[model samples]
Target: MKLNRRTVLSGLAAGSAVLAAPMVMAQGAPRVVVVGGGAGGATAARYIAKDSGGAVNVTLIEPTRQYYTCFFSNLYLGGVRDMDGLGHGYGTLAADYGINVVHDWAVGVDRDAKTVALASGATVPYDRLILSPGIDFKDGAVPGWDVSAQSAMPHAYKGGSQTELLKAQILAMPEGGRFAMVAPPNPYRCPPGPYERVSMVAHTLKEINPTAKILIVDPKANFSKQALFEEGWQKHYGGMIERIGPDFGGENVSVNPSEMTLDIDGVVEQVDVCNVIPAQKAGEIAHAAGITEGDWAPVNAADMSSKMDEAIHVLGDAAAQGDMPKSGFSANSQAKVCANAVLGALTDSRVFPAKFSNTCWSLIAPEDGVKVGASYEATEEKIASTGGFISETGEDEATRAQTYQESVGWYAAITSDMFG
Candidate 1:
């Protein structure tokens, strides 16, 4: 079956049991604890809670009271979206679905004891643990940069404050100033994120500081939707953006956040703003749980179960699942598959076949959006791609506008799917 948004929702509703009344917990119900309340965790928590019909106790551990999405954050940077529009609270999940939404940091995980230790000195025991802690920057991935320099050179990879800081810095740049972005290597969260960010930054600068220039110091030879993004950049922001690839020593780079300088292959240039997107790995709790292989936690393709522990499932950007890019759509898709498996394991629910789909939409200019997506199924080795589609370059204005509209609708649908 085609695993589109509507299909996913309908299939879930048909396969799972009806939603149980709030606070109706069965005696000795199995407890499921989910860490990181972003796309994967929140969706997983909501699905399990709603589907189990109070047959399982669900507790979601997220540090933030208001969860802001990393997706579409670039639109906020570009003034297309507001900051308030990006944040979502878990009140509905708590009051409506009867989930225990704990706003506390999950500092450590004891897989042996099936407990998660929080910063509040509380140990929350779980029969099943779902980790969707998202990506954390790999230390020393970008030379001369660390968390200490975030204020001066914000990564802005994470949502919320860092995004605000980066946009603020952009607005504060001097006229004709240079904005440099150090793109991360492959296997980072959101492959099109940096490019879309460049597009949004260019969009912002063209209005306020028309003479400002943008530089991309990219380590990779090619990037996601390269042809489409390059085409849009030339058509919209010509002569304002320059990219240096590995051939031009873009791979050998360093930054001085204090001085606001970017050094490319021994050539240092003054820059007004530097957005460093470093190589990323699974969040710290995954490592603490000893489930990570190298940088990411490997999971079984059928259920997103961690290779190290069957009781633990790793989802989203943190999991080294094959074929699927690290994206919010992908995470949300994986969450449904995982939720079905977890529901079956815990509550004896009817589990559907594991199918996944992802579509990444990027807004190059106002009402000009392009998308790439694929369908996948579980294989013995991984979640292998089966078929795909992409927005072709040189599409008509009407087509691009329609794509943009589709993206807007998707955002609304997904946020509702996640938060509600």
Candidate 2:
């Protein structure tokens, strides 16, 4: 059966409505300072403010007023969506949800003082801190590639202008030219993202330059929805996409922007375009706060509270939650769970058990979409998946088309939930 976003996300939306009851505050409201006003932070801030009524003060700290979602970004690359459609402002989160939206980088986290120091030199004290800062590239994760060369070969993983730049580059590629992608390793954000991107790029090239080629230099042995994506690629974009995995020297990679050269072990190929999506770690603030044990900050599986400090909670890609794939839906689900737990601790309200779900839909072409999803329950150790489903390789055309429609619905609903 095809999974509809409305049906899958009904629990999340309804949970917010039910949990959000106006509260009467006795005195000053407890303050929650949220860093990274993306999926997890925005939802957490909105839910806490709405449900707590005037009883809890919520402040959201984000560097940008407009956040472009990483989810569905590949569609924009494929010319299916536009930049304006991808951009969302925090005005509603501030004006409607009563959250103190601050557009500033959280420079330092003084856990001892229970305060967050802003890049603007202001310190905001908080009863609890919510950290949802997303992924940051690991320094030198890929040889011969860094931030300075991103214009030549964009990751476009973060969306916004990066997505635009990549699209422009793809359009400008010479006829019969080659496009290369340096796919990230295991445990990166959005496990199926690289393959979906390859599909999108192939879609665009087929329309403009059918002779062009798309090369995926993947180190991993396999990827999410591997069979489904492989089938779709063969059916829709036959002879356009070539994925070279570790068995074929995909691991040893280096790039030269000056010469437009990509080196895979002993073999060197010159490509017109390159996308270097290197290794990633939790965002900078997570390490700045000293919450991260290694690449990611460890959190309590039940509440997403930082294992280091009970007063701090980490969510989204930055958090090391068990069995949860790092996706927009997962982050939003974790946010709701974190909000309920945080507010319950502060306001002495009822805290319900955390239930989470995530669905990742990727479009191979027009009306040809594939998806994988799971429902999770908070176990004593991790956010363990109870059951899951993925789009079958031989599913009917109608089902694939319906899945695309479901993704469209999800983008609208999830964005509204985050920024509404």
Candidate 3:
């Protein structure tokens, strides 16, 4: 159950051999190469492979052997769920779903030849390309934050070594040590992620060091589920967590990791642990392929085809999907819509208009959950939301409990949809 890199790769190898014939057929029959095997890419591969029924070839290219979901990652940090629960293997996508899993990074997109070049020196041509490479941090956005400092103060946004590093830092901190979190500006991946992480860290610190503190330095004055978070912090954690918004002069204007200090306006603050989540843009691959216009790729709402290039379809967090928050659920939902459109395009059939849905859950305590959800429908020009819900600002205890149950059910359903 604890799916790690080695185990997952071994599983893929065994499965690949068994499904070799089907894979060959799939490969030979009108190929589609999907880059990035994270939530969106993996989901697209699975659905296309299933629905195409060996008539369409689906090859998924990703460097990693296993994927770690950002959705429930905060639970892992809180010790509510084991890392095994968050870890997923692509063996089923290859074996049961008949998707060809290529364990290589996509180095180049040759639009002229309609092929993708791998770092391993293999060139896989495709009839169409679906890209969902996710988001990449914007360089120079935070002056002193770079790859080297990432080891000492891990962002944990990418969910691999950074996750382990942050976990270690928290575990190794002395009793009553301070943990400072710098949340990004609006429109980042997992809107509730940083807040959820704060709650989870608070959950851990309360047990290990009751007197320890968490300081959140946010750029925005208000955040997702602000009242609910405050209520939970006051009721259970009891002032262990403190928030500093821009209005309250909580901005981390500058950072110097070598000195272990952050300059907030004119004041200098020091902490045992630091988590800096910076501004972001589309992934490097999309930028290299010339699909991104500014921070994100613009795509046609009807089929996720790039507005810049019809042959390339962009999905997930990297796409500039107006009115759609960049969350794992949103990425997965968009992938399904993209898959259906790709199938229709290849076969020259009518593409069905899709309704997309997303729900993000955050755990402020072990069983307490806060959530925001939305349902969207596509128009001729844009993907527009029809309805949405946020956990009521001042809900009763019973309502909060019901939302928590819904959050748990959603986690189960989403993981099933992805890997089952």
RMSD of each: 6.4, 7.3, 5.5
- The residue-by-residue lDDT of candidate 2 on 1-420, one tens digit each, is 666876545644554443322222335779999999888998899888877876888889999978999998999888888888989999877655667889999999998899999999999999999999999999888888999989988989897888899899999999999999999997889998988999999999999999999999989988899998999999989999998999999988998888889999889999999999999999999999999988999999889999999999999999998998998899999999999999899989999999999999999988999899999998878889999999988999999999999999999999999988
Q: Please tell me which model should have the higher TM-score, number 2 or number 3.
A: 2
Better of 1 and 2 by TM-score: 1
Each candidate's TM vs. the true structure? 0.95, 0.94, 0.92
TM-score for candidate 3: 0.92
Global CA lDDT computed for model 3? 0.82
- In the range 265-308, model 3's lDDT, one tens digit per residue, is 66788888898888888888898888888888998877788998
TM-score: model 2 vs. ground truth: 0.94
lDDT of 1 by residue, 170-205 (tens): 999999999999999998999999999999999999
Worst lDDT run of 10 residues, candidate 3, spans 15-24
Best by lDDT: 1
What does the lDDT read for residue 286 in candidate 3? 93
Report the Cα lDDT for residue 245, model 1: 98
